[model samples]
Target chain A: MSTTVDRPLRADARRNREKVLDAARGAFAETGLHAQIEDIARRAGVGVGTVYRHFPTKDALVAALAEAHFAHLADIVEAGARREGDAWEVFAATILDSAAPTAGDAALCEIIAGHPQAIEAAALGQERLKAATGALMGAAQRAGQMRDDATVQDVQAIMCGFGQVAAAQRAGAQMDWQRYLTIALDGLRAR
Target chain B: MSTTVDRPLRADARRNREKVLDAARGAFAETGLHAQIEDIARRAGVGVGTVYRHFPTKDALVAALAEAHFAHLADIVEAGARREGDAWEVFAATILDSAAPTAGDAALCEIIAGHPQAIEAAALGQERLKAATGALMGAAQRAGQMRDDATVQDVQAIMCGFGQVAAAQRAGAQMDWQRYLTIALDGLRAR
Candidate 1:
């Protein structure tokens, strides 16, 4: 019985790990960085012991949350940048899509805004973002699909604005956030 | 002696009220809406008694905070919208100016986001904002400065995005926030 318990527990631990990440992401999104890990465990349908085993501390969990989002963002950017679509279109679409309803986006953003460690991780994430945005901008400029004066920094700014719109949408405070992005995109397109 | 004392106290009360608002705005900007009222009083070089006496409650103080900002925003938008500058340019500039470093912008934002009461008060504020933004869009559309398809809803979305950029700037989390607003503005402008 003891041997059987140990073997099954390993599988349970793996399941709990994924569960913990999912719950932590949801809790952090709803309540920001200060969300209680205990609540996260409950949301994950796991015991506190399982949560602790999967993520020893909140910071570790936060790191994981941000890391997951960053990886996803990087993949999206890479894929989009390689596509034949207009560079700006692909870049803007990827950003808008990443910010769209996703499991961990809120959690990722909360961590970036409120946690030092997460911000540092986001710095690395930003580097990748910069590269992807740059590639898009360069392509668009070459294609005469974007203005020559635009910079990657400009793309970064748009992302910041996008975040604002996204936040308002989440809070149920506004419904036009996406429309504003479209308006701004119109301004950004080749003139 | 009693009359004399009352007169001086009334004058003192007025002075304290001004001080509390100033300090609260600064504190809110720095620490978000959670900045303590007592700290605000202390920063204003006044007693907590004076703060409570002048504003009665934190909700009252927060309402005053939102009201003041909304009024100011309305004024800027109205003034800018009425000006001879191109519609799109004025719109972009007005939104950008709001994001610039100011003494109380952050605090004002904090009071609105940190407290539910302040957010409720924001409806009136939003109405004012809509009016101002609508004026700008209307004029821009008339002048062929913006796309005919644009609506006030589009401006509202940009405003929400601008708010996020402003908050991130206040938190020092975003450096490119304003630039993105400019890029987005490009999309809103006429072809």
Candidate 2:
């Protein structure tokens, strides 16, 4: 009887946590790190007190979001590596797919570019992402599909560059990333 | 006799103005737009009153710098186009050479990325830069030596992206723009 009573309560807590995280991600993506905790709580359909219980501060929430972002990126690269196909195609597809803007991507880019403290909190997830991308890059290079001179670090820098371009476009710069990616992908190919 | 006396005073004023601009460029490049005009006046070996006499305000000074930046870029592109060489080579060299960081580059990137007011103040310079680069792109594409699908705006976007990567590296991100530029150049090449 004790286990049954505790089970529903624990499940309710878990569901509420997930709702808060989802709402926070959306809020952060749209309004950036300035998104308010009260607004997030309202969006999550939870009380402000519940949000504070889950995350004592906005910084803690941002760190959580950063970890989730790295994990999502790692998952994408690892999944692409697992698929049996042309290594170049897989690599290009992975990059292009990941570059596709989701609601969370703006938040992820902000964390990577602007929040060093949040990144420190997500160190483990970043390591996982680095390892996953390194393996994929190695496989692509070995298959003689990708340029040998490029490092995994180089790829990361390029993606950061793309994120910058995307952000500028969103700010009304009147340029698109599709052609930019095409040029970058072409440059990445082996001579 | 009065004209002769006025000539020397005018020349002295011109020299002082140039010194202030040079000092401001270095200061702004190192420390961004927040660089104090007092410090710039000191660096230029002039008084704060002299700085105010020349430009009146920080915004006016920044606008002047922005205009100079665009004029420099325009000169580079127009000069490159006039050189007798492969159109592609000229285009690539102009892009690569401009992408190379100089003392004023950080300030240029900051102005381009962060200051809409400065850009507006330099509208005529920006228009000249656009026209110059557009002619170069058109020549390269017409020669069948550059990719036709790309636009002058695309080139501008890529440079802005490169600027973003460069800024991040300066902030201690472990990446370099040399390899990034190499890859970007490769991408811009015609197959």
Candidate 3:
């Protein structure tokens, strides 16, 4: 939905919007949601007014960021869902692939988790991400590839917890995210 | 060592020490490490001097609390080590049992994670806990019960991550810790 939003903007306006999104992505990746909007505008080489006019609220900008990631995740999920092999294998790949991007950036993870104190535009991103994950997980459960007891929320919380672990790992905590992810995947299998 | 710290003290002095520990535990459990020394003393019905005399710093008090947890965890690990059956089973029991306690409390998990900005006393507790866990895991690995690639730190990180999932679940996230723990255990098993 976000990617298709178009109202026939001026050429300069479109360029400015693209610049703001790029700057915001880099800024959020570096310092998370706490990166000041002024810094993002400066990095974009645009006036703060230009940035604000493009996205009226910080959350709206965050939603834009989230929109990008979730869209990528959705693409991955759709691919996984389309796979012909074992449902569990497909689901496992989906989980690992879906989380890989957000786990690499604390800011991205923060935006994805929808920290109640931050990211006002989280609802749409949350919904989209939820649907993608659900589709994959639901397929697995229906095929008896995953534990019947497993819920989409369970996968989400595990993903979020790992995101924190990624941040901790960056902070010098020794951990291997992939190894742990494999373990989580194994755990999701039907008993 | 902390539990048996020997010193001559008047009965009221002993009472004050116990009271301070109680109040500090409650405060930290409720509000995390940010709970103030002044508040702890007031809650304990003791003078600030009494609290200060017992714990010269918040880190010291936090260390004392951490000491209790590690001691409990050590007991679990030692019990697992003493078990006669499969090493992995004993070790898994120990991991889940140990995490079950602190996972129920937010402050305890924060203390365990050794947040860079908080809980400075965590190092000693971490060291003790690590040593105990290492002994159990090392035995399991030596006996070919667990995957050789697994390390004590890996297990610790997973356990801490689960502590987070527990918190998230409390906040209404859907997840089954035991099920996930099973996956981690399976991952640790020898192929």
Q: Highest lDDT among the candidates is held by which one?
A: 2
Ranking by TM-score: 1, 2, 3
lDDT of 2 at A64: 92
Best by DockQ: 1
lDDT of 1 by residue, A15-96 (tens): 8888898888788888777789889989999888878887777787888777767767766777778888656677678656
Model 3 scores a TM of: 0.76
Q: Write candidate 2's Cα lDDT for B1-191 as tens digits.
A: 46555434578899999999999988888877779999999999999999998998999998998888877777777787777778887888877776674323666666654356887888887787788788888888899877888777877767766776676676678877767777876787777
Model 1 DockQ class: medium
Worst 10 residues of 2 chain A by lDDT: A101-110
How accurate is chain B of model 2, given as a TM-score from 0 to 1?
Answer: 0.82
> By DockQ, is 1 or 3 better?
1
- The list of candidate 1 runs beyond 4 A from truth reads A1-12, A47-53, A101-105, A109-116, A122-125, B1-9, B98-104, B109-119, B173-178
DockQ values per model: 0.49, 0.48, 0.34
Native-referenced TM-scores of chain A, all candidate models: 0.77, 0.82, 0.83
At residue A85, candidate 3 shows an lDDT of: 80
Candidate 3 CAPRI category: acceptable
lDDT of 3 by residue, B1-191 (tens): 57987779989989999999999889887776679999999999988898989888887888888777767766776666677777777788888887788776667766554365443444565666778788788888999977788888678667756766665555455566666566656667776
Tens digits of per-residue lDDT, candidate 1, B1-191, equal 46554545577777877888899888877876678988998999988888988888877887887777777777677777777866667877886775454323665544332334575776676687778788878887898888888777666566555555556666665455556557666677778
Model 1: lDDT of residue B12: 70
Residue A6 displacement in candidate 2 (angstroms) = 18
Which of the two, 1 or 3, has more TM-score?
A: 1
lDDT of 3 by residue, A76-130 (tens): 7767777778777788887788778878776876544435434334455566667
